[model samples]
Target: MTVFDDGERPRGGGPWPIWGIPLVLSLCGLVMIASLSLRNSMTGGSPYAQIVKQCVFFLSGLVLMFACAFSSLRRFRRWSGLLWFIALLLLVGTLIPGLGVRVGGARRWLDLRLMRFQPLEFLLLAVPLFLADRLDRSRREGFQGFLRPTLMVTLLSILPLLFQPNLGGTILVTLICLMMHVENRGWRYPLMGGAFMVVLFVSLVMIEPYRMRRFLAFWDPWSDPMNKGFQIIQGLVAFCNGRLFGVGIGKGLQEDEYLPAAQTDYIFPAIGEEFGLAGTLFLLSLYAVWTIRAYRIYRRCSNPFLSVLTLGLTMSIIGPMFINIGGVTKLMPLTGIPLPFVSAGGSAMLFMWAKVGILMRINKISLGEGRREREPEGC
Candidate 1:
C-alpha cells in the first residue's frame, strides 16, 4: 500500500506543515537572538547589528532551502562524492594559517571576508549523501561491507573534525554515520562500531586537558563555580529566574553579562529566561512533532537511499538539539554545540534549512509520487 492516498497528500506542492515548524522556530529564534544580544549590541555601538545579520542569514537560508527542495535527489546523489570532497578540503583549509580564522582558541572557520563559515556544518549533509551513495553501490555483506564505507567516512570526515578540536562535531558526525549504518546493516555491525566509537571518544577526551575539564565540570560544577562552573551556574539561574512564564523577552539578566555565549551555545537558557518554562516546553514540542514527521517519512520511503538519508538528516538536527539543550540545563557537559534553528550561526542555519528542504522533498516523493519497488541489488 502507498504511504498516502491522493487525497491525503500535502497540498500546494510541498510539505507545508513539516516545513512550517522550523520556520516558526526560526522566527522565534530571531526574536530570542535580538533579546539575548541586546546588551552586546548596545555595548558595541549598534543595537540592531546582530539581529540584522541574523535576518540576512535567515533569508539566505530560505533561498537555499527552496532551491534544494526543488532539485532532484538523483542529482544530489550523483554529486555526493564531489560535495564530500569539497567539504573535506574546506575542513583541511581551516587549519591553514592565513585562511582559517581562530576564535576563542579554536580554528574552525574559513575567513570569507563577508562572513565566516564553519566547515563541519557542510559535513552534516555531505556525510549522509556520501554514505547513501556508497551503500547503494556496495554488494559485500558482513564486516567487509560495513568496514569499507565506515572507514572511508571516518578517515575523510571524522578525522578533520577531531583535529579541528571540535569534539562535539566529531561525536555528532560519528552518531550520524552510526545511525545510517544501523539502518542499513542492522544491529551487529553498528553495535561493534558503537563500542569502538565509545572507546575512541573517551581516549580523545582524556588526551585533551580542556575537554577533560569540561567533562569534569559536568559532574561537579560547584568545584570551580567561579571558573569552569560559571556558565552552567548562570544557565541554572536563568531557568530559575524564568519560573513559569519567563522574565518577559529582553528583560532577562543572564544575557546582559552573566551568561557567556548566551546567543549561541546557551541560547536555550536564554529562551527559558525570557520566555519561561511554558515557552520552553512549547519550543520542545515543535521539535518533537517535527521529528515524528521525519520518522513517518522515513518509514514510508521505499528507496533505501532515501530511507537512510532521512534517518541521518533527522538525527543531525535532533542530536544537536538534545546536546545543546541538555548542556544548558546541566544535564550534560557543555559541548559548544549550537541549538539547531535557534542559535546564532550562519553556516548552521543554512545547513539546517537545506536539510529541512531535503526532508520535505523526500516526503513529497514518498507520499505524493507513490513508491518504487526496486531495492539496491544485494539487499
Candidate 2:
C-alpha cells in the first residue's frame, strides 16, 4: 500500500472538523455573551445592542479569514512585514495622548470613528504570518541563519506590546514566535527565548509597584480585597455562589453589582456563577478540542508556512484563553486580557475570527496536497 493508505486521504474540501470546532465554539460564545450581557444591554441601551456589534465583527472577521485562507502563503510572506509596520504605526498612534482611546487607564485602542480597535490584535496575525514565512524560508540556509532576523522581528513585535503595559499580550506574542523557533530550530532556541523572557519579566515586576501587588495577590488575594485584590475577591465570590449547576443564564449576582469588569476580564467567574461548573467545563472542553484539532492541522499540512501558521494561531487562541480563565478563577494573577470569543471587544473578535478563517483555508491546502506526511524538523 502507498504511504497515504492509512485512512489519511486528501479531503475534497478543507477538513470540516477543524474549522467546525472553532465555529461552534464561537457560536456558543456568542449565545453566552448575548445572554450574559442581556441585563447590561437593557440597562445601558437596547437588549440587542452588544449582540449586534458582536455579529457585525464576527461576520467581518469571517470575510477576512476566508480571504487570507485562499490567498497564497507566498503572498503573506511578501506582505507580512508591511502589515507589521502598519500595526506598529497604529501602536505608536495609541501612545499619543489624544489619538489613542483610553478606557480605564491604559491607552491601547485607536478611535477609528465607527469603532475602536486595538492595534495589538493585528500584530497577533501579522507577526506570526511574517515569522512563519521568513523562518520556514530560512531553513534552506540553516537554523543559525534565522537567528538575527528572528530576534529582530520578534523584538520589534514585542516592544509595542510591552509599551502598552500589556504584559499578558506581550508574553503571549513572544511565545507564539518561540513556537515557530521550536518547529524550526528545536528546544535550544525556545529555552534561550524562555530565559530572556524570565529576565524581562523580572525587570518589569521590579520596576512596577502594581505588578508586584498583583504577584503578591496571586500568592494570596484576600490579603487586600478592597485594594489590590478586589477583582479576584469578587471572582471567588461568584464561584462560591455557583453551587453545583448554576444560577442560570442572565441571573448571575456578580453582574448585578458586585464584580467590576464582570463582562470583560471577570466574565468566566460570571459564567461559573450563572452557568455553574458544568457550563464552565463545557466551554473549556471546547477550547481543548479546538487546540487539539488545530495542532492536528499543523501536523497534517505539507507546507511549512501552513504548519507554522497553524501553530501560531493555536497559541494565539489557547494562550490568552487559558490565562484569562486562570486569572478570573484566581489560579493566576489578575492580568487584564479578554476571554477568547466570549469577551465583548470588536477588534479582538474580528482578528480572532479572521485567524480562524485562515485556519480553514490552510486545511483546504492540506487536503489538496493529499494526506500530508509528517514534515521535517524545519517547519
Candidate 3:
C-alpha cells in the first residue's frame, strides 16, 4: 500500500517494511554487543559467552516479534490484564530475597532457571498495553471516562517501578502513561498530575539523602568525583577520548578497564569512544527514524487504544536512548539506564523486541493484515 492511502484495511495481508527497521537495528546490536563483550568475555572465561547469549535473546525476540505481529490486538486486549498481572507478579517476586538477582547495586532481576530477567522491562511494555486496552473499552461505552482508570493504572504501574529503584524505567513508564492520559482525557489531568508529582518527588527526595546527592551530582559530577559522581566523570573521559573519528571498534580504552559499568549503564560512552562522533550521529539518526515511523503509525491507527500503545512503546525506546546517551555526554545527569538494543542484558533486549512486536502488531492490525511481511516490505 502507498503511504498516503487511507485504507486501514490490510489488503490480502500485504507486505510492509516496518519489520526491517528493527531487524536491521537488531543486527547492528549483535555487532556492538559482541565487540563490547570481547574483553571481559575472552578473559573472564568463555570467549563467545556474551555473544552466544545475545544471539539467543535475538532469536527469542524474533519469534516474539512475528508472534505479536500476527496475533490480533483484540486477543491481546482480552488477555492484556493477565499479561500485566503476570509482569507485576514477577516485579514483586524480584523483591523477595533469593528470587531477585543483584548486580552492581540494584536488585531488579528475577533469577529463573533458564535466564535472569528484569521484570520492569516486561512491565514497561505490558502496562501500556493494559492501560490502552482498558481505557479504550471504557471510552467506547462512555462512562465517567478515561480519568479514573488512567490514574489508577498509572499509579499501579509506576509505584512498583519506583520501589525497585529503577528510576529511569519509572520515568519512561510515567511519561508514556501521561502521554496516553493527555491523548484520551485532555490537558487538565497532566497539568494537575505534574504538580502533584513534583510535590511527591520533593518529599521522596528529602526522605532519601542519596536522592538529593544524585540530583546535585547530575548537575556537576566533579563535585563528588570519588563517590556519586564517578560514572559521569568516566563517561566524560570516554567522549573526550573520541574527539572526532573515535578510537576504533573494540579498541575502547575505557572498556578495557577505566570506565565503570562499561557494559551496562555506561555502554554509550564505550560506543562514543569506539565509534566516534560520526558513528554516534548515525546511531542517533536510527532512533530518529524509528521515532518518526512510530509517530506515523500512531497517527494512522484507527483504534485509539493501539495508537496510545504505539506511542508508549515508542517513548519507552526513545526515553532510554536519550537518558543513556545524554547522561554519558554530561548533557543530563547520570541515570542508570541501558542503551536499548546495544546494551548487554537479556530482559532489556527481550522486552525491547516485544515492544517492536507490539508496534508491528499494531501496524498489522491497523491495516487489517494477518501474516507479517518481514524485511521492511514497505508500508
Task: Please name the candidate that would achieve the greatest TM-score relative to the true structure.
Answer: 1
For residues 1-379, could you state the per-residue lDDT of candidate 1 as single tens digits? Answer: 2222233333333477678999999999999988876786557757688899999999999998999887778778888999999999999988999999888778889999999999988988899888977876788789998787965686569787777778788888888887787777776777788898889999988988888998888888889999988888899999999999998988998655888888899888888988899999999999999887787777766667778888888998999998898888888787789998889989999999999888877887776452353322311
For all predicted structures, in order, the TM-scores are 0.93, 0.89, 0.88
Candidate 1 stretches with Cα past 4 Å from truth are: 1-14, 370-379
- Ordered by lDDT, highest first, the candidates read 1, 2, 3
lDDT of 2: 0.75
Q: Which wins on TM-score, candidate 1 or candidate 2?
A: 1
lDDT (10s digit) by residue, model 2, range 1-379: 2211244533343456555766776676677678766676547667787778888887777777778666655556678889888988888888887788876566779988888889988888888888877876674434465465577677888787677777887887888888776765566667787898879988998798878978998788789878777778888888888877888877787546687887678778888888788878888898888776776677676566667777887788788898898888778776788888777778887888778877776676666552253322332
Identify the superior model by TM-score, candidate 2 or candidate 3.
Answer: 2
Report how far residue 191 has shifted in candidate 3, in Å. Answer: 1.9
Off by over 4 Å in 2: 1-14, 41-44, 139-146, 369-379
- Superposed on all Cα atoms, the candidates' RMSDs to the truth, in angstroms, are 3.9, 4.4, 4.8
Per-residue lDDT of model 3, residues 213-312, tens digit only: 8878878788999887887787888888877888888888764667887767777777778888877777788778777777677766655666667777
Superposition-based RMSD of candidate 1 using all C-alpha atoms, in angstroms: 3.9
Enumerate residue pairs that collide in model 1: 246-276
Looking at model 3, report the run of 10 residues with the lowest lDDT sum. Answer: 370-379
lDDT computed for candidate 3 = 0.73
